[model samples]
Target: MKKEIGSEFWTVEQTAEKQHLFNAFKRNQRFFLSGRTALDFLIKNIKAKKPIRKAYLPSYCCHSMIQPFLDNDIEVIFYEVLIKENKLMIKVDPNVECDLFYTIQYFGFVDEQLDDFIRKIKQQGKLIVEDATHSLFTAKAFHTEADYVFASLRKWTGLPGGALVWSNETLYAPASKTDSNKAYIEKREAAYRLKRRYIEGEPIEKKAFLTLFDEAEQMLDKDYRGYGCGQEIQEQIEHLDIAKIKKNRQENAAFLCEKLRFCKDIELLYKAVKQDTCPVFVPIIVKKHQRDPLRAFLIQQNIYCPIHWPISPMHKLNVGTEALYKNTLSLVCDQRYEIEDMTSIVNAIIQFFERK
Candidate 1:
């Protein structure tokens, strides 16, 4: 094989264990499954009628994540993020009285601020449905007082499916008996397998992944039930020693942060709060003009930094918030990467700036 930049990074937790855990702990008051896990407390359980004024969303989230409420005939309101600010506190529309709110642990850093947001939403008698897809197994994950929480094992753990978790003392209504989407589940499993192999210094073609994605997309068009869906793939979402993952990523991040602090042109998005967060990824928000060039330079050197939440302007509401959308590109920090990997990334970035 030709000399290749070895792709080892974070490894995922086991799948079978996560699925078994899901099956055994179906103790939420009433749960539903779908493309994304949703806790429709009103629908899942018997709750008093609270007219949903609108559904509030953080502008930085994926549309598919917010689709559950939209599909259920609710209006959507967006929460603006102060991306330019130091702490990046989220700004909500106080006037928009909502019956439900979509809270995301953005890159797994939803600490005390999350609680403050939740308290405000709960006062309005609205359900705070948290997307734990990114912030799995953190201190807040297992022991949370949040009304509803759901996580996809694929994001952080080595699992094929997701879990719809809620209060341990709650019950759920069974739906989506037709899980013909097993093929998609299988594809997800296979994709992870191939991706892991390639990440482990094994060769994998980019085309192979694109082909799998196409196949999965076809299945969704044909076999998808409305909401609350899954395959019969049972598994547990497991993680490597999270403490070790956190330590490694932090060490790598700190080294890069030191290197990046002096770069007059590149804007670091958020400060690394290591102990408080199990950061899902690392991102550096750059000036709109600087983003592409910086990404290009890094890619040329095989650094492979990626962009997160690149906007799709399909939603009319996505327009006004464009100013708040800081152009961000990410550097990998999963435990699979060593500090030396980060040093190389910093060197590539330094060379790029020096060339300019």
Candidate 2:
């Protein structure tokens, strides 16, 4: 199936947790646990043990990833993506006074600053959960003893559900009482059927429909009601092929980076810095306003290309939405695409802008 692994939803053919995310959809009847969303669970796990009032956030990221806390009325502070090579940058929220702060290892680079930041926060008796949805495999979610951690399984493992993984056992998270996860199961089947259809050429209206197969069932995360982060697509994040998937993704990323290095239009996406390897998604900043025209051209050629984000972080806080899209685009460069596909995408991109 044409994987939309870029948007944090994946096939959960492996485990029950994965199925919960995919099939459960938003009708979270299953673990009506004490905490609702992943962020809530994270908050409860905070060392304070009291209500988590505040935390840090990636200026540019999937808003839904942090929605649960906001839905439950937790404070979310904003931080900018530092160009300072792997070091996380932050500015405190006004009048919000939150001890807890969180940061993401974007592109999965687990830099020294990330560790130092966490240590500094924990020293003050706060919390930091490494949001590893994007960089799960690259940076070990459980690597450092950050109070709590969570990964969007679908992003890397391609599972459906996303939640917290706590290191300190003292943290609190009540066990869910809700039984019989019918909704989650149903969504899983829906995803599976969608995949089967796309694979069998089952009459999709457009190739774009393929990406929505997993995204359609996402739950609106309430954390961003203040600014509108988005809903979590608690789809089936299951069936982690581990070694094979990692190998495929890493190889694909390396291949593209090497071959497309000279492509004038496609700017280098992320710094490939993982020591182990196995990367799948590749992002790029396009050179011109040719996103629509170029994308349309690629589509006509039966080449499926898509942008990754909706809004830039600069615009998230009403700071500066001007650079919202600029040249930012995320094209599918996973294991599914072969060398020929990469070549086609690269040549098409270069040719499109080269003509300009």
Candidate 3:
């Protein structure tokens, strides 16, 4: 049988190369248990310096991205993100009152229009914070003029818990000690090990790892405290081949864009991969009625794709934004897979539509 195409990453084996991943950063940086914790640390630091009354955020975002601001008593005002002719456009009024502005590099593709919007707001003395979770591998990840930048490393690699918060200027020390969620980390580590064994043809049941992953995710959700990176996870980061990973992701994403161009009932969010982009996922917008069905069908073929997000009911989104959320699906095109793997993904997606 063919190996599963996509899901959670498996743990990386110890390698002789010690590239020192953090050394690439020219700014002061701190590690955290997850992206949310990193963002929380930044939020508290900003609050300590000044009163943040209101912040502008993109409508297409995960709840974790918004929770840190809300926890600090900051009001969140979401701006619209619309797609036309397969390009993403930002709609925000310059006259809106906001103390802070948050931006994202969606799916590792830089939106030039959003950058211009950020520049316009920055000129007005609005504090800027960028979430680089999806764009960590891209060249634009740390080149921002934002006051703070943070990314969750776990999304891109096989680490139990890893994230980084950085700034061009000195960052204030975290107020609290890093969280010691031993159970959560241990469960995720176990899941990674089991997944590696399963991929290597071990006589293991898939449910074993899946259950552990779910438990770990639940534990993480319940705990909102900030955490520092553990020693072991840091060591693993040092061994990563950052350049190779970026190259693989770019090639795979480019291949998918070409292969999926003619797919019926599916629209590629990005028509071409930019020179500097290292895509986290090759996102596509499906017909609203077929999105869930296509996702279910892919899972049956041992290919797992994730929805970009499921917005909370608390944020009453407009009809256009709501439709975008419902129809969008993030396809796996990370470093884990190569051309052959991506071809399989394309074929599976084609098969799904042909059956309809």
C-alpha lDDT of candidate 3 relative to the true structure: 0.83
Measured by TM-score, how close is model 1 to the native structure? 0.78
Tell me each candidate's TM-score.
0.78, 0.72, 0.94
Residue-wise C-alpha lDDT for candidate 1, range 1-356, written one tens digit per residue: 22222232223533222333333334462223333544343334324334555677787776566555555667777777655453455777544777667777767655566676677667776767667766664445532445666665445444444445555444444444434346776776676667666556677885675577568656654544434444433323332355566676667766777778777666666565456566666667675467788877776776766565656642433444554444677777666668778778878777877787
Backbone clash count for every predicted candidate, in the order shown: 24, 26, 0
Answer with 1 or 3, whichever has the higher TM-score.
Answer: 3
Provide the lDDT at 194 for model 1.
70
User: In what order do the candidates fall by lDDT, top score first?
Assistant: 3, 1, 2
Off by over 4 Å in 3: 13-15, 22-25
lDDT of each: 0.58, 0.50, 0.83
Instruction: Give me the overall lDDT of model 1.
Output: 0.58
> How good is model 3 by TM-score?
0.94
Regarding lDDT, does 1 or 3 come out ahead? Answer: 3
Instruction: Report the Cα lDDT for residue 316, model 2.
Output: 55
